[model samples]
Target: MAFRPAQYAALLLGALTLSACARSPAENPQERSVIQNEDPFVAAMDEATNAAAAADRSARKTPSKPQQSDAPRVDTTAPKLSPAELRQRILRLTAGLQSAADTEAERVSRFLGVSFTPELMSIREGESIGDLEQVGSYRVSVSRIDRTAPGKHVRISFGPAGFSTGRPSICTFELAEFADALRSQGYDAGEVHLPHREQWGFVRYVSASDLTFYVSAELYRANDGTRSGKLCLADVTADAVKGRQ
Candidate 1:
């Protein structure tokens, strides 16, 4: 009933060939990429890579905020200065000396360090300049019509407070101290009375040669409610008292 040796050997050879043919393409290394595309592990990795690429593209397309400049901001608006402080700054900056040169342009420029243009056609009263020049927030004029034993009477006047863009008022009594300040600086300054308008006027420096300084202005109101005037700081050469001679 048993098979012969030759027959058994032939059966074994056939079985081996069938077993080799039965193996799937997935089991072969050359066909592994085809299988990997369908594998859950490979599919997850591809999905992660695509998601990362999409996020990168979206980030690139989104707009970013603009950067600000590092430069400092400048304030061109003028500031109001107290009368006393204004006087001090002017005197200190010029060292209480003003140039008396005939070159009016150079004189003003040296005093203020700012350029100015005067209306030469406006000069009046024999060397008294009625021309108004803008010095920041105030108007300025120079005069030397009166010459005295001390020298030429140089008068620099400043117009009122509306120059700095505010309604700043001043008490008339405060000017007395400023007059005293001039006297302290070796100026023959004195207060003069003007009853009709409540004017507290002062004449400073009989001989400054010629002084240049900014005069701050303040609005002063009278009791009548109808009268208002500007209180100002002026640098001048005093004229001789009338009737004294």
Candidate 2:
């Protein structure tokens, strides 16, 4: 029996629906084509998108070589001051001492060219300079031009004095002189003092500039008359004075 046109058309539509439902996922050419064309659509989205992705990759990548930081730099090669300028700087630093004793001390210290904080002077008188246990003794003198334009004299006795004879003398001096004296003597020194007091420590002199120097001495003692000492010298300059002050 021959099918009518309407029946044949209906049968054809049913067959198409059944085939579509039963088709394997791999056989879906339209779906596969959509996936295959996806890359082109993404690439054509915009020129900026590709450029931005490249830039991102570049930013995330590390440089094979070391890179310099954008920090401030110091200029270490500037011309230094002349001798005259250095002398002026020294004079400016020493100008503040008004006492005759202080002036002489400062002048001599400057002549030694040693940088120091300040002279700590202590003196004591006892039955014997050695009677004080753990004390040290040394002689110090200074010469300077006075306000009256005359040469002035200043002298000091340095070392550990008997507490009973006088108060313990303590003062801070410049580190430059202390270091210089140590270096001159071929002795290595550190900024820190020894944990225990030393006896007979003496600083002869330190050179700071052509005209400057620093000198110092220290003495340590025990209750049983045991004594030890230390000495320091330093060169004082404008920079040293500024740093200390």
Q: What tens digits encode model 1's per-residue C-alpha lDDT throughout 1-245?
A: 22133432332334335335432346666566666676777556657878999999998999976768665533322234444444554444224333334224345334433333433444321222222223233223333332322222223334344423432343222455565665465444223332232222222222344332212222243133234443444432222221111
The count of residue-pair clashes in candidate 2 stands at 39
- The CA lDDT at 8 in model 1 is 27
lDDT of 2 by residue, 172-243 (tens): 233345445445543333222333432122111112221211212233222332243123211221101111
Q: Which residue ranges in model 1 land beyond 4 Å of their true spot? A: 1-85, 89-105, 122-136, 143-173, 198-245
| Reference-based lDDT, residue 44, model 1 | 66
Worst 10 residues of 2 by lDDT: 123-132
In order of appearance, the predictions have TM-scores of 0.34, 0.18
